[model samples]
Target: MSMTLALRRSIQTTPEQTATVFHGRRQSFCRFGDRVARLASALRTQGMGSGDRVGMLGVNSDRWLEVMMGVWWGGGVLNPVNTRWSGPEIVYSLDDSDTGILLVDDHFLHQVEGIRTTARRPPLLIHVGEQAVPEGMLSLEALMAASAPMDDAHRAGSDLACILYTGGTTGFPKGVMHSHGTLWAIGIQRLAQTPMPGGSVALHVAPLFHMGGMGRALVQFIAGETHVLLSSFDAREVMQTIERERVSDLLLVPTMLQALITHPEFDCFDLSSLRRMVYGTSPIAEAVLERALDLLPHVAFTHSYGLTELGSATTNPPHNHGAQGRASGLSRSAGRANAGLAVKVVNGDGVELPRGEVGELVVAGPNLMLGYWNKPQETAQALRGGWLYTGDGAHMDGDGYVFIVDRLKDMIVSGGENVYSAEVENVIARHPGVMSCAVIGVPHPQWGEAVHAVVVRKPGAALEAPDLHAHCKAFIAGYKCPKSIEFREALPLSAAGKVLKRELRAPHWAGQSRQVG
Candidate 1:
């Protein structure tokens, strides 16, 4: 019913058990619960009332978990800002959600001034970093130390818990709202499908801001498992942590898995403790999957498929990655729908398509998001007739396995991040170089898909790739910037005068098995 219930249960049953490990700092369940309560008390003292919004801008750390639970405990909704975004993007999300109290770490101190100057209503700043607190910001450590521990607010069942921002087709990010009930339902569904082992130690390398990372963390908490935190993903650091902490579970994108398996000293680490590995965000290459299976024969692999709006919809179980499943071509599919969830491929007219027919994937489940915050029309478009119309081109076989063939939305998944082509194109169009552009994803060896832009320059103006790249970096995140740019006199267009993105992406993905990465 409520996420905080998990914390209370752990405190009652296993108060002495280790709950969190980060950079040599470990906290038991009892200590963690007390800190969370204190932080919640501090938030309440800072004018955060029930249903108020609080934003956090930081990487993965023990404090991140505390802030998340503390907000819920204090009856506030969480808005976890994307660290990779530029100042304007972050400001848009915070301002859109009307977040009043913003948490910052040392890594993002430089952006505080810009946020204060640009945000419609500047928020109160709280420092949650290891470094010394900034002059004007309140220190989280000081607040927790000074405030008295408070009781949980007991907000549960349809109470708004989080507003997660996802890349939007309208050249901005949209806040996807998820209630406590929806999130709790998804966690239970995942557990029912693949139960975690007792005394499991989960390693957190994925960014906590994204759904994939946050959902996995929530499941670990629901199961009362220990967590090993990492500030960010570094190949060597991840391997070292796995060996040192004896990590039993992990979630990764195919790109991270590739980097881990191909590390020069990968075999030197004693990764025998690792028992389960769940990968998603993008399909894995056949070669990469085979290599990982050969190297970690003891590990069970699962591929999870879902969106921000619909939390874990389907999961390709461990057996599907084995020899028999591979021979049957099941390894290439995204697996069946999760328990209590319904999935089907529907045509453009909202009619369900027959099996083996590629169409847009639609899902109906309790895990579906409440709606996009403050955007009624968009929400209506996404959720209609009791099904969330996922903009993914896929098909279901007779056995109910879903195989994603392409993306119906003009979005690209690169290195586990969603990059909307419209967002990138908007930034490029602002350049004085005066041009029209189309952005698409190209086949990439490591990133799975790389952002590629095709542009037609103004007749008299001379714009180069380097200049455009620098221009884009000034306005958008580095990962969304084009990895390659092509200049042309004219771009291929359709009868409707829309630029043909499929034509732009065709040559690059000539022989790939799937159009999507």
Candidate 2:
């Protein structure tokens, strides 16, 4: 069933059920569905039809969800614009997708004019903001008020659902094409991994634009759960929302979890209502995991592993975490593939590797994207033999739990020895004063590419490079210890919280195709 059908079912079964709570704004499923239908009708009335692309440029808001549903309802594809991207980057994605209508929130309205100057321009602009409607853009609220709820066209599962752009990479962003069936499989896989009762309240902390954002958000619709929304993740604010709304579940990346654990008021809030935490999109420090277990021992933690293309497919269920079986280190392991999916690591030859041996991780699944948008050659390159070449490197244990080693591109070869950045970064994160760390290969005349660590230290903490160097040396091979350490105020992260290694390594890789030999 389409996502819109799911919501309509929820409205019929539990009309009074709260659909979302966005920064003090709350709406029931009935109300939310009505708005979705009206907005869908509005887009349809504006000449949008099946297979067309609808663009939404906004931060987290109730309107964002409504607009997305409208696009899907009208049989158009939803293209959620990344708020962090620059104009040129945004223009490329918009133009590449051929987005004909743009639904924008206030903060990004300034980008609308630039969007118009692209080769082809959107025909209609609906400004979504609390502020008065700007001169040229149409008021989204006004349009919603003017339209009638649309009749559900009930699009097929094979129909296109969304176009997610990731740059949130090294090169120019590519639009990952995901379909309704892909999303449906994702929703079911995620729901089975974390069993939430009907009354569950989930926090919307991640950006709604990224894959992880909507992937988790779909869980709410599937379970008919209440979504407690936060416009952005501020540690204290999120803690307070959990206290106030009794948010039952939410997902956070390792960096975000660290910030929350370190927040001054972390202990001040009554967060016992929180029951489940789904974390991924990057590895979490072992220290941070220990800290979370200490603070909220009752909270079941789950780790999901997948990319935008796979619709966030793999999951390590709640049963595998903690002191129970973590003695096997399975708790920290990335986990097994989700239902309806296959994961295996392969060598440079694209041949599968033996179990427990690390190689490039590839996945084949119903959740995998049809292809990259409008890039057939790239599509053929990625989806070879029905398997999506993940470009990520990982290995599976004897028990079948998958452990992500590192990105294939980020793997460093020095003295003919393979070095995974995650291995070094994971060790560096053990440092008490280190908030987060990303390891990248930097050009070295002798070794070719030497291990370099870019670390973010805890606030007001004194941590010297030599101190960290000594720490890593104690646990890992001295060679794996960062040959050089660089400190940053904050590690640059994509919308999903994965460290942008391309951005991190850009300085050193500028003159070359990439740093490693």
Candidate 3:
């Protein structure tokens, strides 16, 4: 079934129920459906065609969700831009996807000029913020008001839904494409694993551009629950929203969870309304988990594990976080495969490994992405023999619990964002003073892992950390830039002359039980 089916059902069954809450604004299912229809009509009038790609570059808000549904309602594809990326990076995605219409918020107005100058064909700009409409750009409200409500296009099954960009090992980002069928499968699998309570209200803290955030939002919509949105993650604001809205559900990463539970005025707010939380994208520190379990004894905690290529393959239920499960060490597992999904560890030759033997994790399910956009070779490498190679080194116990040990790919998860080491190293190696460099993820207190760089300087060159920092800032996002830098005369290398990143990362992860945070 198409995702729009959820909205259609909500409008038919509970038109007066609250659909979205953003800041002080609230919209009922009836009103929300009307706005979505109008927006879809506006998009069609603006020349959006069936299967065309439309991009939304903004923070999380009611309008963001509206645009997402409207695009599909109008029979168009969605390409949600990464809010943290630099101008060039954003341009690359827009150009790569051939997005013809782009929506911008107040927070991203500064990027418009860069996009216009650099993009192959600059998209038609529509201002979605509360600020005064910019010259030569159309106002979203005006367009919606001018257009009449339109019918749902009923796009479903193999029809493309979204193109989500993920960091690449080739110093570029690749677009991961998903169809309506795949997304519908993910929602069904999630619901079958852990059902949402009736009248559950979910507060979104993670960016809507992320799979973790968007995937959970899909599940909530499928369950016909109320949504409360925050433009970004703010500990105090999250606490206030939960208390005021009586939010019962949340989807947060380890970093956001830590910030919320460790806030100075954490106890000042009445957060008793929250009942269930799902955390993923990075491993949680044992100390933080213990503290949270103690502080929020009534809340059920679940851990999820998945990737953009394959949405939500496994979910550790709340029972695994309790005292009994902790004593049995089940808390460390990423849980078994969700309903209708299959996960297995395999050797290098695609042969299944024995249970308890560490190997690459592969998943097979209806939730697997169609493929990477415009990259047939990469898609083949990722999806082979009806299985998606996850690039995660893991082992499954006899009971089917999967434990992640390391990343087979040169990638890092810091503050719930994926950073490719090759992408960062590419930016650093561009510095004329740097002879060689390697990027690795180091243990971090707040971000779970931090991007760290080790550089070998050119003889007689005065390359400092500040110089490299400034250089990287020009090409990549701030989070992808190195949090710390160290200089060495020579880097440890193998016989093949490849830098041994394991040695460099070992010092920083000395006491960590696993290579990943």
Candidate 4:
């Protein structure tokens, strides 16, 4: 179940299928597979081996897919660098992963141009952009052109496929090691659940480095569907692409959905080609989701739940949100485990608690990543008894729906009381003046950690702390209300659209061993 085999199969099954569309060029599956094979052979000549890590930092493009497939075909591991990170932050991941070959698009070349002074510099550079390789970097086009296409390595099981770096407790990103078996299983399962026959166009508007975008693209690719690539999300461009390409499926975050639904020209666009609207990464405020549902009546909404540790689209059963009895279960739940995945909610002592008890959700399944790369201790702690202990606190109801309460760390401990930040954030988002908000734990001399909120207001709205406090007080307990508030033009967000509460709470924990709970 190597991704290489999947690519080869797509080419054989439907050679003429549009494998990728980026910057107005469409490449067929057969041509895409041949490029991948030649690139793999070229990378092999350049010293990438079975488990060697190859770092990629680039804007999304056809080349990203080509190089990623090339890495796998070369029997190497991919280490996808986050597009939004400081130079030191980027360097830290390269050092931690010991990546030898660093690939970069032109937009990010300036970031690594002077990284050689560091002890952990990548040995080689592959330029993945249009313009000529700037002076010293190896030309990506030349490498593929010089090499001959190679055959399958035939690794159809749990071999390390890619290392996706995600933010960790160490205050830097941890590399998540996903296997070929796991990645392929999740992709095939998604295609089985939502069959994308040959002509179906899958839009990759989400960043490819993240799990959701990667999963969505793979699912469509395995079925020989057209790939509509978007470098970065633009709400207007998303709708325009749908109309132009006759896109069938789109993976979106709640933030993107809000922007699209509220776009002034949304009503004017021909969006009927869209059949599925899958959302996750973060919870959507109820009103925003409801409004989106009302606006796009023809599309089926599938709420996905999973992180990089467990591949995205973990649980996406077809559901009708308006159905009276089903709505109560599905709306508040993150659906049941998708095929090849198993989920359980466990207590602090690691005992599997009975249904309806709010415990830390743990997943034991094929979709779970192999482990955290280069962090054996952290990996062992996370992968206990074959289950990945997701920090997310959740409870499974009788019908097996997972209700995510909050992250065990994000659950506020205030004066001996447990307050979930997601609970407070949900309430704060209800305020008309609030465009977005993140609840974080701050220094409290008496209570240990006090609830603090950073808010981004709606454009042209007059908002005051007192008014916001009163608003939250109406919906949730006063203890969970923000004791301090900071107004920002925009909140810090990860590629997946998750609010970085850790970054927001950094100042408060400067001199102490920070407690997440």
> Which prediction has more favorable TM-score, 1 or 2?
1
Q: How accurate is candidate 4 locally (lDDT)?
A: 0.79
How do the residues 85-180 of candidate 2 rate in per-residue lDDT, one tens digit apiece?
Answer: 666667778888988888888888788787777536644787888998987888878877899888876775888899998632333467888888
Off-target runs (Cα >4 Å) in candidate 2 are 168-170, 410-517
Please give the TM-score that candidate 4 achieves against the real structure.
Answer: 0.80
* lDDT by candidate, in order shown: 0.92, 0.79, 0.93, 0.79
Report how far residue 457 has shifted in candidate 2, in Å.
30
lDDT of 3 by residue, 10-105 (tens): 999999999999999999999999999999999999999999999999999999999999999999999999999999999999999999999999
lDDT of 2 at 139: 81
Put down candidate 1 lDDT per residue, 1-517, tens digits, no spaces: 9999999999999999999999999999999999999999999999899999999999899999999999999999999999999999999999999999999988899999999899999999999988989888999999988999999999999999999999999898999999999989988988877788798999999999999899998899899989899999988899899999999999998999999999999988899999999999875788999999899999999889989897788889999999999999898889899999999999999999999999999999999999999989889999999999889999999989999999999888999999999999999999888479999998888888889999889888889999999999988899999999999999899999999888888898898877343
TM-score of predicted model 2? 0.80
Residue pairs clashing, model 4: 1-156
Candidate 1's TM-score: 0.99
> Candidate 2: lDDT of 187?
85
